[model samples]
Target: MRDTVIYAHRGLNHAAPENTLAAFAAASRSGVTWIETDTDILADGTAVIMHDSRTDRTTNRSGSIYDLTTSDLDTIDAGSWFSGDFVGERVPTLRELVSFLGPHDLNLNLELKGNTQGRDRSIRLVETVLEELRRLRPGTRVLISSFSPLLLAEVHRRTDAYELAWLVDKGTIGEDWRSVMELCGATALHPSTAVVSNRCVVEEIRRAGFGVNVWTVNSVQEANKLVNWGCTGIITDIADQMVEAGRRR
Candidate 1:
């Protein structure tokens, strides 16, 4: 069997705050080669690494990410919510993340958080992210994923340099998955674990020559099952445990 890739979902997030440089650094130090994180554009048009459209959950300050500029993000503490150890952690911009991971042999799976406002904003978000990625070192592997079909289509329209993956949950992934994938020109499908529980689904997608990557998989037993069914990658919160388990297998 081919070895399945393990991506530290939001960087060894269980050990450090999700989406912070400290979390990413922890993942890197633990021998994880791939890191999966979210990105959204700020009010100032700067692309920042954050999972939510709002900053209430991950930061000390409460506000919509759309309402906050880069300067506003400076005072917000992104890591303290998770633990006292990361009290001063700031949200890393996409530019900052790329530069930080530039020296390491790490791959990035950047999930574009959709703009709730409209398509124009979503397109702009994609544009801003692409511009930031241009600074990545040559030979760095990157995958752009989104739950928004419009965003994926925009990425396909703009450039074919990076691999694109369509992120879908059980409800969003319809029976016409193949058609949807073709429409977005996605090389892979990132489905939630709930959707991939039916093993035949994984078999079907892999047989069609497209990669399958699952999200939020924290259990080793579940991870093994997916890998055995030809999963291309497993995005997990427990990177250290998963890596050791993969080694034992």
Candidate 2:
């Protein structure tokens, strides 16, 4: 009800390939001004939009994202897996996504993927993402979330230019939600829908002075329930439905 924003989770993946430009465009067309996407670095230290460490699930290529350079990533077909309608779509760099969303006044929820390679690589991921945000879209509202405390801490250490949110599961928030938030210097919490579907927990998180944005909420009933409960944001795969649900409140 009260300005509960609907963020398109992975850019409405039900309609297009996840994390691709095609998916982002589809979400925008569906009247979504907020989109959530994953960010991982390539071998060349280029920040790119991708959900998985490997390309097998989303693209025609076969290799770990960290092993591939930006050129290697661009050569693969990223859209065909979802449908032929998105045939020629290539993987987009974070810079590309930022440039695309900046002028449109669209907000982004960029999830930072952990560097499976090592600690140095993880620090680099944080640096690369922050540098992109500072350079490409300085004035834009971007919320950065991650389950990795190391990564979030790295981000917090480098810059506080953007809002940071700690992503947590049911067990992770048991009695230490505030502690976790303080540890990462995060002002927000991105809890799994399975964990936060309980209205009491949502109230608890809000009472702790942390904004709650639940993830992957797709159904209108669920969306309405959360919005009515005064959740700050709902990350959904069905942005249109959730937007309508928010309006109904």
Candidate 3:
């Protein structure tokens, strides 16, 4: 049996609020080694851990993440929406996340959220994230990923310290994925489950020498299939379940 790595999507988001320390803790307790989360820049240049550009869905506040500062986030409850047990969870900064995971043996797959503010803002976000990583230099392995080719390219240009991955949805994946990956200096491809349904597609990508890591997978059967197809990583919300399934296989 292949040893496919299981990455807890948003830190075992199914068990706790997505992107919260609680979820990450839960994942750690479940024996997960890889965590996949999103990071975005705030108004005051702080890089925060979140999956959306807006705080409406995940927090008590309703505003763009770009318009909010660290102080503003202090008043926001990032966990209440998911469950009362996590009521006081605040949105964590990238630095905080790095510190939090420092003692653990977990690897991070940090997805850079696309900025709608413009190219300059995007560059700032990239630089801010890279700077944070450089400053802390956490013990855990880090892989920076983004759906934006421009963002990935910028990351590639600024630093070669961390690995880069290009994210693509099913319909957006084109025949030129290889060329784009090369241009962005990405060492891996994170594609949606839909894109990897065709076995040959997974084989082709692995043949090209880029690691294949599929995202948001929840089904054990599906994960088994992907692993059999030579997928290097499985990003899933149900980490404990997936880990057990892998053991059984």
Best by TM-score: 1
In order, candidate lDDTs are: 0.90, 0.84, 0.89
Candidate 3, 135-194: lDDT as tens digits: 554467899999998899999998899899999998888999999999999999999998
Q: Write the residue-wise lDDT of candidate 1 on 1-249 in tens digits.
A: 127888999999999999999999999999898999999888788899999988899999888988889899779999889999999899999999999887867889999987886777777898899999999999889999999877898899999999999999999989899998989989999999998988899999999889999998989888888888889999999988999887886
Model 3 TM-score, 2 decimals = 0.96
Per-residue lDDT of model 2, residues 84-164, tens digit only: 998878999998998888766678999999778898888888888877887555566888999886678778887888789
What's the lDDT of the predicted structure labeled candidate 1?
A: 0.90
Question: Where is model 1 poorest over a 10-residue stretch in terms of lDDT?
Answer: 1-10
In order of TM-score, best first, we have 1, 3, 2
Residue 246 C-alpha lDDT in model 1: 74
Residue 219 lDDT, candidate 2, scale 0-100: 82
Give the C-alpha miss distance for residue 18 in model 3, angstroms: 0.4
Q: Pick the candidate with the highest lDDT.
A: 1
Which pairs, if any, clash in model 3? Answer: none
